[model samples]
Target: MKNNIILSWIEEGVVSIPSFLFSEYKSIGLTDLECMLILQLHAFMEKGNSFPTLEELSNRMTLSLEQCSQTLGSLLTRGYLEILKGHTDQGIYFEKYSLQPLWKKLINHQLLVEKEQTEQQLKLEEGSLFTIFEQEFARPLSPMECETLAMWIDNDHHNPALIKAALQESVMSGKLNFRYIDRILFEWKKNGIQTVDQAKQQGKKFRSHQQKTKVEERKKGGTDTVPFYNWLES
Candidate 1:
């Protein structure tokens, strides 16, 4: 008897509900009862009953037929549901429900949320970059310096982290000026260095080359120490 019941239950099939509907329905301004009605409608549509009567829907839920009708009306008014007309090959016309608007609202809401998150993250990064620059320079940035920083990010599309790395490189070379930092950025760009690690590797190579040149200079009896890398020369 239990095996028969299980088999019958399996034969009844299952309704596929989008996972986001459960989590985000409330955010999209759907009340719990309205969302439940939508789920019931989805189940009926999935089972090939595109237009279940309110009596049939109410039979499955605690709501009365009139309540189901009113809830469906609310869904229609809110643009979350639509009644679409169609015709069969026999030229018979019928009305069916379409959940396309509901799906569109969910998708558009998710995209808007992601866009907001990305914008917030960009603002935080820009703020932190400015703070780091001010701390390193030991003074507030001038209006022109601020404009240059914004230009590097907004116009030149340089990564803030990569710019920070360039500033560090300038500091290490004892040149803590905007022009020196700009030169470092330009040299890194010319060398196709898009990341801080790549810039560091390139710096290592330049230092090695400088060391080899100094050795050759020593052999030629030249004794002026090449202390800092001149990115302007590079």
Candidate 2:
């Protein structure tokens, strides 16, 4: 019966995913093992709102005692469970493992720290206004793009002031990403734009050009219309 219960839990769904699980894991990633471990925790918790002992789980899963112990240790370290040591009715004491209830709270703290560091790094880069972007938007940035942004901010090659202005323009124009930033930098380099004003001017001109093209396209058939503008504009 004990083995049947364990198997039934596994068969029902080796993992009990909360409704918010996907959105939470989307930022990082979740693994099958992690999911299974959490489900096991849910099952054991049902007995008396306490974690199952290593021996009980081992016997139920038909795993060697050593394997069960190791598995529990790994699950605890990986943030899937938290082990609480306590005493039972008998004089012999034992430990219990259960899912942490305040996981979202913990995640918020980590995110806050990462955001602060990224903003400070951006500020130190080329003294560009692009650092303000950190305050306005929070998106998953790739490691490579993050490094590039850091380098750009550390050096003055990208003109911090112009970068900041361009970033604002991009945000207003519904464009954000390293690719867009790189394109702005390339255009600035070509036009020898040194001040924020130059960048803003170019941005205004680009907007005007876009508006004209959109108006022209409306005059023509919106669909099946192709213009010989730059790749980005197209």
Candidate 3:
């Protein structure tokens, strides 16, 4: 019976385990062995909904019986897994392990902290206009572009709100760059774009023609790339 139980356990990688066990495993931080055990245990449980035998877990992890038993005991004590009731050819065995809820709560807290850190970093980045300029253009603003942006923000006292909105729109549409902003201003100054709606409409028009030209030129083995600033200069 012991041999049969061991063989059955060998067939399955998991000893009976509870969900809370892995949650605790994550909280205590899983070592390589623990991680391997968790992965194998999960697989075994998935197949039979029973605990894996000592031989089974060892085989799955390529570990010695002693090593697998010791690790399992540690996990059981750490509140990461629990054994339920079981019977086998060898005799009766404890059930698979289970996790406790406290571990789940802790893991959730850690995830929340990570998410907040990311959001805070983004907010700090968004605080500065220069950072936005650098990211959008992939290169620093040219002397002329810098001068225009500075004048627009500092001297003309242009609506900071509108500038920010336009900047965001440009970046999202992949049309962001000093030349793009300059073009928008040039047109706006010429009665071409006066509001966000007009700016969006202009972007759509540019995209339509840009796509059309690209497809046509590609068919002819030619490129239809144009420098946004060069068009204005011409």
Q: By lDDT, who's the top model here? A: 1
**What C-alpha lDDT values do all the predictions have?**
0.91, 0.63, 0.65
My TM-score estimates for the predictions, one after another, are 0.75, 0.38, 0.36
Worst 10 residues of 3 by lDDT: 225-234
Q: Residues 133-183, candidate 1, lDDT per residue (tens digit)?
A: 999999999999999999999998888888999999888888899999999
Q: How well does candidate 2 match the true structure in TM-score terms? A: 0.38
Q: TM-score: which candidate is best?
A: 1
Q: How far is candidate 2 from the true structure (C-alpha RMSD, Å)?
A: 14.7
Cα TM-score of candidate 3: 0.36
Ranking by lDDT: 1, 3, 2
lDDT of 2 by residue, 182-203 (tens): 6777777778988888877776
lDDT of 3: 0.65
Clashes of each: 0, 6, 26
Q: What residue pairs are clashing in model 1?
A: none
How do the candidates rank by TM-score, highest first?
Answer: 1, 2, 3
lDDT for 143 (candidate 3): 81
- lDDT of predicted model 1: 0.91
